[model samples]
Target: MNILLTGGTGYIGSHTAVALGQSGHEVTLLDNLSNSDTAVIDRIAQIIGKRPSFVHGDVRDTALVRELIKVHSIDAVVHFAGLKAVGESVAHPVDYYANNVQGTVSLLQAMQAESVKSLIFSSSATVYGVPQYLPYDEDHPTRAINPYGRTKLHVEEILHDVAQSDASWRVACLRYFNPVGAHESGLIGESPRGIPNNLMPFIAQVAIGMRSELQVFGDDYPTPDGTGVRDYIHVMDLAEGHVAALDYLNGRPGWSAINLGTGQGYSVLEVMQAFERANGCAIPYAIAPRRSGDLAAYYASAEQAHKLLGWSAKRSLDEMCASTWRYYQTGV
Candidate 1:
């Protein structure tokens, strides 16, 4: 199958490109190089032994998306292009809405114009804001708190409505948890520009001496160690989940929203300790106040993904830390 990934050069998208390529699918990467680096294209080629076709463009450009779909004969799309920082979104709601929601609308419009219906949207677990229960499933209520989560929720609703209006549309909304770790080869990893918003990268930077010390955000949550707890899925596992979703979409035509996670929640201190053990380095840290809208503990049911897509996260927390450290040492 021919697949087009919207943010194909970003962390998860780059890993998924390799997964898809290894699975014998032709991948055309379309990214604007906003938060991602162009060097990822070469890294993917190094790992897969074949380079994916890349377009240096944004998803908000409908004309370019349509042209690319026709030119590449794209059979399906895996949409992952958007602004994804929770704190930043809270500060810049309009930018988040325009880039995430409107960008998705533009991509869908282009796909409709070209009669390309199959789509796998990159949704987030944030949509299940402040989970009423411990583990969230597809049936969990979506009450996005921040602007970023709201954008993802809005796009998901739009996709649902599109699929309902036309039976020809096949949509898979994969709600991902915290995606951490790097490829085993250490060729590609999460390299967020400027200060990292995620925890794992921030920890990695501190371990590598890029940063002075790690800031433990609010060690007073109701979790085990008083810090917040989150489900962190290995990026490679997340990538493979996409491949499984694509295979599940072969003959199916409907909207299916599945959670991609490990079904286990690890507190902030647990992760920091794991990273220290994995990297054999002591990380300096200080306790800081918790950020607003941060959840105490949240994870996924993960049963739906295993039953529907035949996928579950295979990497352990230790492996996540080790792989990330390996990539960090590579300086790429």
Candidate 2:
């Protein structure tokens, strides 16, 4: 199958591109290099022995998207292009909405214009907002609190309405939890442009002497370690989940949201400890107040994912740390 991956040069998209390539599918990457590097395409080629065709453009460009779809004879699309930082979104809601929400609308419009209906959307567990219950399922209500989460929720709502209107649309909305780690090859990984917003990258930089002590946000949360807990799924596992989702979407006509996670929550301290164990270095830290809209603990049920896509996260916390550290040491 020929697949078009939006944001394909980014972290999860790069890994998924490798997975798709290894699985005997053709992939074309569409990215604007906003939060990623173009050299990643070569790294992907080094890993998969074939470089995916890349288009340097934004998702909001509907005309370019339609041209790419038609020119590449795209069979399906795995949409991952958007602004993703939660805190940044909180400060810049309009930018987030324009890139995430409006961009998705443009992509859907292009797909509709080209008569391509199969799509795999890069949704987020943030759509669940402050979880009404632990281990959020697909049925969980979407009360996204921040602008970033709200953007994802808005896109999900758009997809839902599109599916309801057209039974031919096969959409898989994979709600991802915290995605960490890197490919085992150490050639490609998450490379945030500025100061890392996520935890693992911050810890990696600190371990690699690029940064000093880590900041443990709010040790007063209601958790075992008094810090916030989250389900950190390995990037490779998350990548494979996309392949599984694509396979499941083959000839299947329906709209479905599935949780992609390990179904286990780990505290910030536990992650630091695991990183220390993985890299053989202590991550010195200081506790800070919790950020607004931060949840104490939340993970995924993941049963529906296993049931529908035959996928489950298999990497341990130690592996996630080790692989990430390896990539950090190797340098992308």
Candidate 3:
């Protein structure tokens, strides 16, 4: 199958591209290089043994997407293009809406026009917002508090409506938890443009001497370590989840929302300790006031993922840290 990845050069998209390539599928990457670098395409080629086709454009351009779909004979699309920063989304809701929400709508329209209905969306656990339950399942309530999350939820709503309108549409909205780690090859990984927003990158920078120390946000949370806890899934596992989702859409013709996580929760301190254990380097840190809207503890119920896509995260925290350290130290 020929697959188009919207933010194909970015972190998760790049890994998914490799997964799709290894899974015997033609991959085309469409990216504008906003939060990612073009050199990533070279790194992807290094890992995949051949360069998947790449298009430098925005997903909001309906005509361009249509052209790519037609020219590549795209069988399905994995939408990942968007502004993903939470604080930035709060300050610039319009950009978030324009890029994340509007871009997806444009992609759907282009797909509809081209008679391509299969899609695997890169949704986030943020769409679940404040956890109403311990392990968030697909049945969890979705009241996204932040603009970044709302953008994802808005796209999900649109997808549900689109699927309801057409029985031929096969869609999977994989709500991902904190996606960390790098490919075991250390060639392709998460490379945020500026200061890293996620915890793992921030810790990686601190460990690599690029950053001074980490901020242990709100050490007074009700967790065991008095810090926020989260489910962190390795990037490769997340990538394989995409491959599973695409396969599930082969004949299954209904919308399915699945969680891509390890169903395990680790605190901020636990992650730092694990990173130190993984790479044998101490991460300097200082506890700071909790960021607004941070939950104390939350993870996923991976049963649906295993039951539906036969996929579950298999990488350990040590592997997540080790691969990330390898990328930062050895990645070109």
State the lDDT of candidate 1 residue by residue for 20-52, as single tens digits: 999999999999998988899999999999989
On lDDT, the leading prediction is 1
Summarize candidate 3's per-residue lDDT along 19-70 as a digit string, tens digits.
Answer: 9999999999999988888888888899889999999999999999999999
Query: Could you tell me which 10 consecutive residues in candidate 2 have the lowest summed lDDT?
Result: 284-293
lDDT of 2 by residue, 1-332 (tens): 99999999999999999999999999999999988989999999999999799999999999999999999999999999999999999889999999999999999999999999999999999999988988899888999989999999999999999999999999999999999999999999887978999999999988888888898889888899899999999999999999999999999998999999999999999999999998898888998888877889999999999999999999999999999999998864
* Residue clash pairs of candidate 1: none
Worst lDDT run of 10 residues, candidate 1, spans 129-138
Whole-model Cα lDDT of every candidate shown, in order: 0.95, 0.94, 0.93
**Error of model 1, residue 170, in angstroms:** 0.3
lDDT of 1 at 246: 97
What value does the lDDT take at residue 65 in candidate 2? 98
TM-score of each: 0.99, 0.99, 0.99
Give the clashing residue pairs of candidate 3, or none.
Answer: none
Q: Judged by lDDT against the true structure, how good is candidate 1? A: 0.95
